[model samples]
Target: MPKDTMTAEQRLQTVIRLGVPDRVPVDPMIYYFAAYYANITVHELWSDMKKYEFAINKCFNELGPWDIYYPINPISPEAYMFILPMKMKLAGLDLPPDEINQVIEEEIMSADEYLTFARSKTPTTFLKYINFLSTLACRVQREQQGEGIFAKTRIIRKMLKQIPVWREEFKRWQARDVAVQHGICMEAPFDTLSMSRGLVSFSYDLMDNPGPLAEVSLALSKGYVKVGDWLTKKTGVRRVLVFCHRTSNDFVSPKQFEQHAFPSLKAIVNGFVERGVTPFLHCDGNWNKNLEYLYELPKGKVVLQFDGRTDIFRAKEIIGGHCCIFGDVPASMLAFGGKEEVTEYCKKLIEKAGKGGGFILAAGCEVAPNARPENVKAMLDSVKKFGYYS
Candidate 1:
């Protein structure tokens, strides 16, 4: 932790208090983006925090003008234990694959394979799980025959445990005064199950097998408590950001979210608030269907990180004062459009959401991998130029 580096605690508190920081928060999930820009693989970058830090700072210096930074965590390999994998490379993206451990393969299998997996404990599980999934997602344009090859069960459970380690690393960034936010999620139980089972199956399970799913929800809540406590204790930070990439109104019907997502999500949000930790939920899609449900989350307990699909003006009307709001710039507009377009979008987002002090200017999602470096610079500059109270 650098004495001069801004702490996550300070950034989060200032944001919640509706106070402008030295600059707007640039809390992006830049794992692959930063690594690729630095000519390093995500696996290598994550394994060596020093490289991860260097890559982030470099990106910030060359490309940023961001206030908050997210240190990348390697995807857990347990998720890919029994499956083939893929990756999502933009036009010119290139990175090598990291190997997964044999034990991870066993652990992710059915209960029948537990004995085989327990024989050996290795870091390879996390590596393999992440490598496999990244490989799988990357192959989306290639074919559909091997789509769900990475959807193993037990392995995902173990991967869930890795949340704490991820948080611990984010804490490291906070200590360095970079004020890192956890990627996607760490505090929401429903989002956790959705990530493990894929949004489709989990949605159906909540309707068809509510009993078992509820049991799983309870169990996951316990895990969230453990992870949240660990984050607070180790990081000594009061604010934690949880990105909701896939769990959005665009992904499922409102009824499905109410039945499958809200209960567990609320449980974890309440848990965080009870402990006095502020929560931020990133919804990277159209949330018009359930913005109210989002507000139903424990009041000030959660902040809304809306994506491009969400209407920032509507979001402000609904929960601006009740909770803080972050993000709304379209990644597409920023990546494929021009400076004026980026500037216009930023101006709109700020005009609509920044009338009050609770709004933060950021991308609706991550600044895309293939986004023009100049475009990213333009986007951040827009915030500085436009995201002011005056």
Candidate 2:
């Protein structure tokens, strides 16, 4: 399998199918790093689509070749936010230009609201509540920061105009061998409830009133599957990224996770698998206690991506040949380590995790904003040096 024989997309797909490709596919989770490389503020990158395109294109052209490029920030839903009246700091309204917008976690819904939502059991109802909370969050920021309302309107206008332009750019990038992986983004049901209901309250509900929360989570899982199906049909991309934040051992005990989180998460994974789509689990936090549970999933239909907290070496030993695995390179190394150090670390990763043919080399999580450019290039270069299969 010579490197020249397959396109970057094909090379990646080969690994996804548990086959050795010409090289281990390099797909760093990049977002604000684009703003850093392009010498623009994160605000500017999200405020204008052209700047966003330029920043990402600069990364591909200057940084090094990438098998896949995430064209937009996962948290910032470009034009769709215009239709749904919600505001997030990631969209560049409340946060400073250089900083990534933080998720302001607050208990917006009451315990009774969970029962109400479950009864309604409609995606529109759930989203309306979320949007309401988001709108209130924006109002609070405006009052506290002394910001004006007109800025949001301007951002919305730019996003509407940029939609078509972004599509065209994606097509162009795909033709250039840098395929864009875009589809519906979802959070595990428990994580979604945590965001809307507040982690403190949700934890209590899991103990005091686990029945209602479990029912609501089941309903939400169905909604997520429907949204994923619609997005796949609309965009012709059969993939979904599911953010499983609280399911990790950092937040829940292994017993709690198995009881409260795993069922809904497995339901979501199974739903997507039944529809012929691949579910990429962005399992953040240290999930050491829960790694074994992943074996229950439909093998080859999931890509288990880890943050630095998860022991990816152990994960590879457990699920390497069963499913595609990506990541666990510490963000700290990329942000502060020298190029030589980064290259050495990458070699170690390839030797351990890249052994069985179903590994994609990536930064454990999103490349930090301050990660050295030379270190990133070293990551891409390491593939050529050590990622080949005979």
Candidate 3:
């Protein structure tokens, strides 16, 4: 396809084919990038779509890259950063740390709370409180452990009956033409489980309650499949990027990952493809450990978005032909590396990965909240200067 002839969606398809364009596509996972460009706080970005739209335009018009993520919800609700599970003593509890912990600990909800929350005909205020606690827990673990702990935590698996209600809400979201695409996920199931059951308890349950765990995961994917189908039907946007933070290669060994995680994920991806929807995996950290399994998916039918921890060179050689390979320009580097380094890195990626098609340029994950405007300029500039095919 000629560069000038491409539509926004078509241009993305071309890049996925590994075909060079008039320029390399710029599709930074914009969340913080939007906030910084708009000169607002992260909180505002989450609550105000108009402000977010302005920020997205600022980056897009100034940077001039490929298709934008164009979030369906205010800041992606699916991201783990927004859904940790920890409890803190609310103000005026007036107990020592140990006693306060015990009091709240007694109130801790069981794994069934996950399904109850998901199955609610209407969202409850208590559900919101649980969601907040989960987010706080995830944040605290990351801060204390220096890596995400949610993957190893215990999650309560709900019965299949609880899922239909959530699916109905998704249908409603679809009927509205809410966004051309709904996220690969409307919510994080595993993250939800972790909040109801703490991480340590959850990890043990994987061994102790493998049957229940497996059942829950299957149920979760079933929910996602309905959502994915509805999104595709409504907007004709079948391409989706599903994200996972705690399940990265660095966090889970192959044996453990394949056993606990892969089954449901594979089902979700297959479900999407069977319905003519594309499944793009948004996995950060080192995926080197699971390359063989990742390759098991249909070639050129899926997309992989990586964080800096992924080996882009090796990933290009491995899955570049079968799936669209996106990202590797680390956000932190863009924040500190300045224009010259950014240009060189992008050029090198183009030369190596942009061969034989199926590559897209993006940040390792998101353009961080504080990434410099000039660094973003450098990325777009480099792609334009070097991304054209002869």
Q: Which candidate is the best by lDDT?
A: 2
Which is superior by TM-score, 2 or 3? 2
Candidate 2: clashing pairs of residues: none
Worst 10 residues of 2 by lDDT: 139-148
Error of model 3, residue 48, in angstroms? 2.1
Tell me the lDDT of model 3 at 135: 36
Task: Report the lDDT tens digits of candidate 2 across residue range 315-358.
Answer: 89888878898886789999999999999999999988999788
Q: Which ten residues in a row have the lowest lDDT in candidate 3?
A: 152-161
Best by TM-score: 2
Candidate 2 Cα outliers beyond 4 Å, as residue runs: 74-92, 121-167
Question: Would you give me the overall lDDT of model 1?
Answer: 0.57
Candidate 3 per-residue lDDT, tens place, 19-70, comes to 5555455566666666667676554554455565576667766765445453
Clashes of each: 20, 0, 17
lDDT of 1 at 390: 36
- 1 or 3, greater by TM-score: 3
